[model samples]
Target chain A: MLLVAPAALYVLVFQIVPVVYGLILSFTEYTPLQRGAPTFVGLQNYAALVGDADFRGALWVTARYTLQVLPVTIAIALVLALLANRSFRGVGIFRSALYVPHIVSLTAVSMIWLWMYSQNGLINDILGTFNLSPQHWLNEPSSALNGVSVMRIWKALGSNMVLLLAGLQTIPKNLYEAASIDGAGRWHLFRHVTLPGLRPMLIYVIATDIIYLSQSFAEIFVLTSGGPLRSTTTVNYLIYTEAFEYSNMGSASAMAFVLFAFIAALTLIALRGGRER
Target chain B: MDRNERHTVYPANRRTFLKTSTAVLGSSLLVSACGGPSGGGSGADGDLTVWWPGVNPTEQDFVTEVLIPAFTEKTGRGAQATFIDWPDMSTRLNAGFSSGTGPDVYGHGPAAVADLVQYGRVEPLDDNLDQLDESDRKDLQTGLESGLVDDVHYLYPIASTGRQVAYNAEHFTDAGLDPDTPPTTFVSLREAAEQLAVHKSGKLQRAGIVFSAEAVGMQQAFTSILWAHGGEMFSEDGTSVLFTSDEGVEALTWYASLYQGDAPVDDNLGGTWDGLPPAQSPLATGDTSMTFTDPATLKQIMDAAPELDLRFMDVLAFDEGDEPAAFGGAATGLMINPDSQMQDDAWEFLKLTGSKDYNSMYAQEVGIVPVRASAIDTDYVKASPAMASAVANSEAFRSNPNIPAWTKIRDTLAQYLEQALNGQGTPKEALDAAAAEIEPILAEGR
Candidate 1:
């Protein structure tokens, strides 16, 4: 009761209710503002979704972003964790320094990164030293998504590094010693003992990445706002645009459901693939 | 880890219960001590709440120098002003209106007013509106009648604003074009733009115009071209969309031709529909030569870049087709919530803010053009070198069709127009698609 009841109540009050209400709204021509009221028609919004070119485009962008950010953030975090796991003189200090960003606010991180990505910002300032011309890092439609992905990668690294640290610590030293006695090389030792030990943690990390990537709103909201053009319009951002800005709550909910199905399918496939590996 | 070792039962359980009951008794006693009112009930009923969203410093100056003092002197009602961004305002307002609370009087865009009125959230100003002096009120331009929903005025059109071509005079002369004579025809406008444009290296240095037709801003821009070519968004009866007409197609073609590839129809992807990452745009840096702007936005630009050296031109006349029409909208005005508790007091504060002296003061501080023709500074309009032509041409401005669902239609039009500009669809296809989507929405209200 203690474990499930509190979370269940919380989900019921905020998440489940809103999702149910939103799903119910998907078939109706529900615009809260202007003239007219909601009138439900079964499968209408779904039919519209099926035909929407913009929705397809958004799905493509979301898949591309998730693929780009997920592996990159994971690889970088693993590298950081490996480096900080060593017993150097300032190893403890380095570990804390690596963990600092995990505790820092997202708004602060996004703001700092936004400044860093600006034309006259840190990256541009460095490029200028080599006599290269400054580029609008977050301005061009092509680079805006990449720029946001880089910031997310930086943010994702901290938390993943912490998880990796826990995974690294749990791997028995006796296993490494046994591998060493068997004349296993450093690569073989790591492959045999460390990799297998970290598999569970890897699965947990991958699941987290799936959930986080699907709901990547803040960085997009603070950064390019799906812009230069609709080049960066993710499914969630697209849903928000339809609901709040256009007042097409009905269509927005339909879009939301479509996004949910997509992410859910991808997550299931990912978990199955991880298990197979 | 043993159960016996883990016993750390709290001693404060009984004490906490006793203290909580005592605190409740103490709180009741405290309430009794404070005596007969809803504990610190709003400092005074004399204080009024007004909502406006614009340049904060300018709004602050207006409140400090004009509205507050004038209201206090006339009726002794102190005003509490709140600022909200125009885009996020609808959400906040809807939330507030749903709950019967906050702010006695507020201001919003004319179209937003229509939506709010439908919800029965705002109070009708017919009583005080009728009380406005007949002669003084007549001077309020008829274009302000756009605030009317169902033939009943839901908003007070406090000030007038319109779009005009803002250009750098220094560049105009250097480009071998006469500063006095701006473009009057579509061909000449293109020629002028070509002359004014400056590029260096691979980077685009300066452009003649930004083709993006934002909702409030560039509405005049793209629409003016359409108007000059004998196209409009709606028919006179407000029943049909006229965007796909031959004139509109020609206008779209002309606009798209300026850019070699991927014209900047809307850098934010129709602004509201798709939010963009926060970064400095070329327009923000004054990288464009001639751009359309309303007076208040122009004033804001000048404030942001005081070194801005620019000239203003009104909407141009067509060669032989249609009359010129600039886009216009209101700044802000006092609106009472019908659901407000203090109805009579709110009305009194509204009257104070709307008084000729107080209102005019409000206008000057906020950099708004006077809505009432009587208040258009006779000396300033005649002599102010910069604003004289604008003042003269202000009379020719027109409002976009006041259909309530026009926001959706307008955004949809922008998207299709963007597609047409990029050669994805013909101008006619774009317009026809928009009309097909919008026709039902317009018919819904009727």
Candidate 2:
């Protein structure tokens, strides 16, 4: 009890307390610049968001981003895991090379992607070689989110691959040998033995990806700044604008809770679907 | 390993982990709750701290090398100077002001004055103004006017920024337009731009001119035109949106016209003002013939491409008959924290920044326009043709409204402006939408 006390208290004071305080703040009209204490305007902040076009647009954008990034990342990650799982020459080097981007700071990664997506960047230079016109990658509203999704998928692939690889190792080799003896093909063995065994890891990956993708902010900030006409504005980015840029803390807190609820709901649905599968 | 074997190795279930964590947390809270806050006081420490948003390495070097040393020598008091980037300055200042921990003195753009005043974080400069001599007062009058909130000045003017229509002289000569004389009206400007433009296939290889849609919602590029047409962003009371009026709509329509004509620009495809480094700017790279630029940008262009022939002229007018208008004022000024305990020392240091000698040196070394009228006429200010024209155009300078909600209002307008430019909506519809969005924000403030 004494050994655990310090660690538990730190989480309670720092993490849990701030979350509860943020919840209370959503019920008030809070501006840090205002001299007086926050005026309680219960449900007013949430009600205003219902009529706010920007808030609705941000919610749609966040959902679109999640749909675009989550599945693609998992799919690519699974393929990489399968490739890396085999006993091949210099496989350790291959695994380490794949994991390099994951170790780099997200901000640095975003900046590198920002440069790559520039009009005259390496991406366009390669496209030019194919006699294709350079596309406005981050500047235009239509393709900005797609550009960010590509970068995000690339960044997330490593972690998902590692997790899936661990799950792959956990599957007993006896099952594969037994299937081979029964005259079952690779497809049949994988369908019956491998997938069921990987169900728990798949659920964890899908649920966590949904949560993180819905909370996207840094990429949008570095790339589009929610512009070329707010096409990349996610709910989290909008919350930052409301709180820091506009100093509307109450409204920002309300938006945060809405996002939290959204992520929680999606995560629950994903887990339930995974279980059913 | 099998599930039963794994369970034997790891006995801690989720339920047990939660129970143990709760027990530990409950006991820990009781022990830690007895402690109190570690710091004291609502005022500043004896030593003074000054913050200035640094533009470049030279600016930072000037502050650390020249300003701090001079202040320490003159006042015999220890002082520290911090150079923050422009984008991060507001966030840092807001946090500092909210927590009563802001620097004793700091410099910021005029647009931030209203927020500082509203938060009661700045000290009024009435006493400082009263102490100044007649000539000193007269010289600072225009610059100081921007710092006033209900006739009480909260900032001491140090430097100002004014916009100019900067053109590539080589491009002008190539297009058969006179290099010495630049366009002074909208029609002539576009005509000149058309002649200078180069299109390759469906893409613009080089634009004739560019209207930058960069920071502060493209106001730096559009405000001069808006003012030329006698448009204001807000009403006198700062309680209502006014840029949705007839003048504003016409100005925006004319501004958007440049995007599709012979002088066609595609800001969406990325151009001069894409927040790239100065070396990659359209003007520097010969991608644009003309742009509405400031002194800092002019300096950057000169630094990046020394061989390029550049010329500066006053911002274009609505018509030949209309007077040239530019967005200018004390763009950056120094203000004292209201809660500063070392108020007198901070004031003494701040006064040095506003002095004519200091400003003249600042203009010479740092390439910023001095706020003091006396300093504006110096040889250094005159040598830079752009700064000289900016000074000449200072009389017509108009600024954004000083209101707490101005940042929000500006952002809203920028979004709609982009929509109109992108053909998503008509200029009237865009402005109307902006008005609709801003009205509620303004009303909330009221």
Candidate 3:
């Protein structure tokens, strides 16, 4: 009990307490600027959310952003992981290069990507060289979310790749050997042996990825600022603007709990599917 | 011990562990909930704590090296100043105020004054204003007026700001326009822009003019135009939306028209050049002939390209012979915390910031408009034509309504304005939608 005290206290203070406080706050009308205890308004904040077009739009954007980025990130990371898992010349350098984006600060990475997506930025310059029209990558509604997604996928690739690479190493050589002895081709061995072996780590990666990706704010903040028509306004982005910018902590907290519930449900669904498989 | 013995021992121990842990957690929770220093305590030894917004290096150096030291020397009271970036100011202030550890004096834009007043977070400065002589008060009237919420002063204005048309004289000359005579009206400005704009292969290579189109910027640009057309954002009491007036539609139409016609003046629809380095600005890069920008950006462009014939126009109106107006006022100013134990010291600090010597020096160093109207006589304003123009037209500057919900209202309006600019809806439709949405926020704020 004493050994577990510090970790338990840390969680209780930092995580559990805040979560409970936030849950309580969601049912009240509060602003940090206002004095006195929060006024209990029951579900008024949540009810207001039901009528808020912006909040509903934000929900769609969040889900779309998650769905758009997750599979692409996972697939690309898996491919990179497979290549890095092999013993080759300068493999460490290759792995390090792939992992650099993960280590760089998200804000810093977003800044660089912000420039790259500008009208006269590197991306447009490349297009210009090929005699193609320059694109307003972050300015247009159609491409703004996608533009942020590209940066997010790039940033997430390194960490996901490292996790999957570790998973790749844990797959016993005997499984591949046994499959090979049975006249199974490389594709068959990957589908049956390698995939099943990687399942647990993949499940862990997907669940966590969904959680983080759904709460994406920094990239959206730096790159688009939930524009050009709020195409990139995620739920977290909305929550932040609500709490800080508008000073409507109750509404913001309600939005946060709704987002938390969503992430929980999505994570559960992913975990259950992975377990079933 | 055998496996069976170990299991039995572990279960018994676990029960004891759980009970003790629960008790410990409960105590900790109770202790934490009840503990911590109460809000509204004076700083250690009564030293003033100040949170000044903006992390500009020059401003930081001036405050820390010159201002604070001078204050201590004058009054024998020490002050600690912390510089915060503009975007992070509200978040930090919110956290600080909630914890009751907020500074004795903090600086923010006038737009935030109402919200602070609404929550009784700020000290009213009406009493402090009496300390200034008649002449000093008169000199500071424009900025002082901006700091008022419900006709009561709250913020001690430090800097004044105005948005005006900053043009490249070289571009005007090259486009066969008179360099000395810049457009005095928006209509003529558009006409000048048509001649100045350069296009190749259906792509705009050079924008004749560019207004700021990024988030908050769009609202400012639109408000400038709206006011120029004699439209108001809200009624005098700030309870009604009036930007949906016919004048507002005309203003929005004119703003939207900049990017609408076959010969569009602006190329980058939603791009931001406001906070870019001087070298990267569209004016410096020759990407635009004229830009609607703040004094700081205009001055930076001049300094970055000394050889270029850069000039700024006074605030422009929609039509000739109409009153010219721009969205501007107290850019930033200091407010005292009501909970501060050092209100007198805080007020003294604010007075120092508003004084001619400090205000002029701050304006000169930071490249912002001084709060005093008399600052026009200062050598810095005389030396910089951009500053002179801002100071000359200080009377024409307007700002968002001083309401607690102004920021929210501004953002809400900005969204619809963006939609109108993008051709998603007519100006009338957008403004009506914005007004409808903003009505409740205004009512709630009231």
Best of the candidates, DockQ: 3
lDDT of each: 0.66, 0.78, 0.88
Pairs of residues at least 3 apart in sequence or in different chains that clash in candidate 3: none
Q: What would the per-residue lDDT of candidate 3 be over residues B1-446, giving only the tens digit for each residue? A: 88888778678678876786567666654443332333353664677888999999999999998899989988799888899999999998887877777899999998898999998889999987987789989888878888899999998899988899999998888889998988988889889999999988887888889877777889999888888988888899988999999989999998898888677778777777543468767888788899999887789889998888889998999897678999887899899988888878888999998899998999888888888889999999999999899999998998677998788988999999999998888999999999999999999988
Tens digits of per-residue lDDT for model 1 on B1-446?
67755443533664664465456545643442232211111234557666666546876787666767766776666777777776677665644543333467777766666556655667777776787777755666443465666666666766666667667677788889888887776667677877777665644557766544333333446677787666787876678878778877787777666654533322222222112221233344655667655555555455555565666776765454557765664545557766455666667766665555656666666556656555556543343333444556666666666666666666666666656654566667877887897888778755
List iRMS (one decimal) for every candidate. Answer: 12.5, 6.3, 3.6
- lDDT for position B211 in model 3: 79
Q: Over the true interface residues, superposed, what is the Cα RMSD of model 2?
A: 6.3
Over A1-277, each residue of candidate 2 has an lDDT whose tens digit, in order, gives 4577688668876887667668877988866655555668999999999998999999999999999899899999988998999999999998988888889887789888877776667898899899887777877777888999999999999889999999989999999999899998989988998888888998999998998899999888877788767888999999998888878888999999999999999999999898888
State residue A237's C-alpha deviation in candidate 3, in Å. 0.6
Expressed as tens digits, the lDDT of each residue in B317-391 for candidate 2 is: 877677777777788888887767777888888888788887788767888777876665799877876677667
Of the pair 1 and 2, which is ahead by lDDT? 2
DockQ pick, better of 2 and 3: 3
Cα lDDT for residue B380, candidate 2: 83
Q: Give the DockQ (2 decimals) of all models.
A: 0.12, 0.25, 0.43
Q: What is the CA-based DockQ of model 2?
A: 0.25
Candidate order, lDDT descending? 3, 2, 1
- Evaluate candidate 2 and give its CAPRI docking class based on DockQ: acceptable
Let me know the DockQ for model 1.
Answer: 0.12
| TM-scores of all candidate predictions against the true structure | 0.79, 0.90, 0.95
Q: At residue A120, what lDDT does model 3 achieve?
A: 66
Which regions of candidate 1 are displaced past 4 Å? A1-16, A23-43, A87-141, B1-51, B54-82, B102-104, B123-127, B184-186, B201-203, B211-220, B261-286, B318-322, B341-351, B354-356, B363-393
Sort the candidates on DockQ, descending order: 3, 2, 1
